[model samples]
Target chain A: MFGVTILGNNSAIPAYDRHPTAQVVTLNEQLFLLDCGEATQMQLSRYKVRRSRINYILISHLHGDHYFGLIGLITSMGLLGREHPLHIYAPAPLQGILQAQLDVAAIVLPFPLHFHALQQEGVLVAEDKFSIECFAVYHRIECWGFIIRENRKPRKINKEQALAYNIPGYFYERLKNGDDYEPRNGETVKNEWVTIPNTPGRSYAYCADTIFNPEVAAKIKGVTMAYHEATYLDNLIERAANRFHSTSKQAATIARLAGIKQLLIGHFSSKYEALEPFLTEAQSIFPNTQLALEGVSYRIL
Target chain B: MFGVTILGNNSAIPAYDRHPTAQVVTLNEQLFLLDCGEATQMQLSRYKVRRSRINYILISHLHGDHYFGLIGLITSMGLLGREHPLHIYAPAPLQGILQAQLDVAAIVLPFPLHFHALQQEGVLVAEDKFSIECFAVYHRIECWGFIIRENRKPRKINKEQALAYNIPGYFYERLKNGDDYEPRNGETVKNEWVTIPNTPGRSYAYCADTIFNPEVAAKIKGVTMAYHEATYLDNLIERAANRFHSTSKQAATIARLAGIKQLLIGHFSSKYEALEPFLTEAQSIFPNTQLALEGVSYRIL
Candidate 1:
């Protein structure tokens, strides 16, 4: 089950019940929070997202709309008696800011918190099945974008053939790894006789708050799913450029340039109450575009 | 129209749709925000409280549930192009915290901010119609409580008598101040003939997070309306004492001991879903007690 859940999708100001930017990426058994904005914890609760299951938090920037809800969420985690280790990947100054908040309240967390400063664009998390990488994006201040890719090669086992060969059910994982089964009767069952190659793993990219830059498109090329910020429509191209944001047309252009399968656009400006125009603009450029609505999950297929 | 609107009333963790502690005090033409918790800005929006009208903010403690929304609210104000000055009265360390947040984002607020540290906690604001004072409260950490008093003595003018005296409408303010009005016709209208003394001004006290202490009741005696934190019910008195929090019965006792006309009990524990027991426990001791429901305005009369 690989998908991205939209918790909040608004920009700097919250309007029309649209909250700031926050997204949860589910890759198999792991959950990674992309960006935590103000009231994100409330959104998480409203959507019935399990806060305890989240182990990784990646902050894209230091904007108040991006990381203001971080303190409340983390403190609530401690109050809920979370004992597992939590990891945070963000800019250098975030460490001091979090420390100051903890110092002021004199809070001693029950869980081990690992802070990874984002200096260079590289791998952030490397697990057995998936890996998350961070890359620089063009914003007014220092910012970053993240991509999570499933990096495993597994084979699909033929159940009929395995059962006919009298193979045990518990050896399916080894069969998927292309291992031959040796039964108690000393009969050798070849791996290729019952196994075939499976489909390749998928990936999802979170293009956190960036301008219209082809370099960003080049970095996340050929991703299965991509989320880009379309803060304004095409008519407000100058305004989007001046604010270091992207328009709907620009976001769709990047998605098309990167050859992504599915494109999700969000971070709508508070000035916009009707979002159909944003959809029209993006879909005109890229047909596989969808509006990132809160509480809705888009499958990474 | 002097009253308090409860924005949030939950304790450390938000549950059952109740948020953290934050209140908006409407004193005539001025608005004062008390203890901005996480998502307080969203609450202000939900309650239709004009964020632009809030000129003063008072933070009681350094708890994350108390002040996590400060940065988001102020930054949104800046983004909305607020030009009026905003005053923040909090602990000394808060100044550095705000500075660090602003430095990371490189945000230059459009309005000038005044930070008044609550060192001794005496007179926070002294205006013509009202005066707000801060006092120490017994909490786990250094906390403070606040009381707002209407200071001016106003006189009620007799409309019939003023019409007979041929007094213009502009002379009403002077008449309220016990000043005799002289018409252009050279007839002196004595203040005693047309005006009568009105009732004394009302007062509201906000006893922030604290334990059961008689000293706090002594500080806010004779207040018209008082809001005390009731973090637990009577059954959890030992837990309340351990956490330096007050139970429902204790909050009512403080109100009764202080001779308050009305009592509001809130800051409910997240463990409880139903809040009717809180009102029942408090009203059992003090009949005028009411539960502080979010978005409900409790008049200071």
Candidate 2:
């Protein structure tokens, strides 16, 4: 039920065949966007991702490659008569930029748009059945990585045990919560006889637009899946550093150090004509690494 | 050599097969961009238009679909190490937006970027061998249409008559300027005896994002070719009016009234699955009208 869909994977300048950074994370029925590059709207349509289904967007930085398509997407949603409220989480500067563009066009949205500013690192941006946390990453501008964790469900109650104890339906809730029930006759019930512990929740981390920083490894440790940017080859390590980006090997190193179950590496530099070298480089360091190909979906579990 | 190459032709919402508004006007070796939509850099590459050859960009307004691609394109050019100066002509507000984006990226151009503000309707945004003039257009924002006129050359001189009159090579410039020449030996050369009048110049007018207005017609009168926006169909006339856009019929009306030699209409509504109706509707009023098909080039002559 939890997965990530790649909309665009190329880094820096978008090429004719490859687009800039953009991805869609589907958590159950809800959709959240990550880094909307130019042509993201087209990519969404190309992948058959319903624009109306997207309720939240997470922007990593103010770079054009990361957020240029946001205004266009918002405008198109308005034009299409989308009535669903949308929330965007990004740096505070993005609000002014979006507001100025909207004001210039004299457009009034039919739905509400909420902007949540990511002013400091290590803040819990949103939490519900799924929780999202933001932490700073090393980039040319202000940027953050996100960790999304699904909330664990309560333990399952043993119906046979409850029935044998002559417990009513109302007492089943207490059993699921690891609480033992007492009947009106003062008969006690053991917790172990009624319920079993809940299964562990899966987690996914998105390290958006950042250079290789060892500090991030601890924060993303033991996640089910992690999407780390690999914007350059190992040979271009200096170039990657100069651009405040990471090489394929560096991305794999982070994933390996974090002990993540699987690694998805993308954001290939535009200078690269083929992606085989990136995969080779990353897999050499982390055997569980995979290339982030466009339109491909990867399950969290 | 006077033709327009469709870089992008879709409306605000870009489709997988179609893009937002963007086109390239090719005048011999020179290229001028019109309405740079999102992902225009990729579109330019897809259409095989040399990014280095684009010297001028004319923005119609502050709409995201019209100018969002500009920053990305500029950034790409910078990354590619392009040294050619780029000139952008748009309303005053656009300068701030573009500058802010460039500043955010901390990009210093290898070439100069000149911003010309178009505040009013009239003569001369740029004048050289090719003269560019901006005329007021009826749009929701402060918009202008561009008229590019290739300067006419003077007629060739009669070699035999020039030799007989012993006209110096230095006097050839004067002779081309339609002045009678007097030789050092007191011989007079009549202006008409040695040179014939020059041929008429070619002109192309870009009527960007606008509603049909009679005033626009008069300003663009006698243009050899005109590119007009047809954003909606007749059934959506009310919507077009509300959006300050034109239907195919309205675009044709302006072309017909302006007495243009030919008309190219694009920026079709995404609701339209086919463009036959637009061409048919426009040609009903102006027989020379043609649909602006992407990747298709149309000669002005």
> Each prediction's interface RMSD?
0.6, 1.4
Candidate 2 residue A98 Cα shift, in angstroms, is 1.0
- Provide DockQ values for all models, in the order shown: 0.73, 0.67
Candidate 1 C-alpha error for residue B90, in Å: 0.7
Q: Which DockQ value does candidate 2 get?
A: 0.67
Enumerate residue pairs that collide in model 2: none
What's model 1's lDDT at B175? 95
- Give per-residue CA lDDT, model 2, range A185-235, as digits (tens): 876888888777788778889998898899889889889999999999999
lDDT of 2 at A152: 78
Model 2 TM-score, 2 decimals: 0.94
Candidate 1, residues B9-126: lDDT per residue as tens digits? 9999989899999999999899999999999999999989999999999999999999999999999999999999999999889999999999999999999999999989588888
DockQ score for candidate 1: 0.73
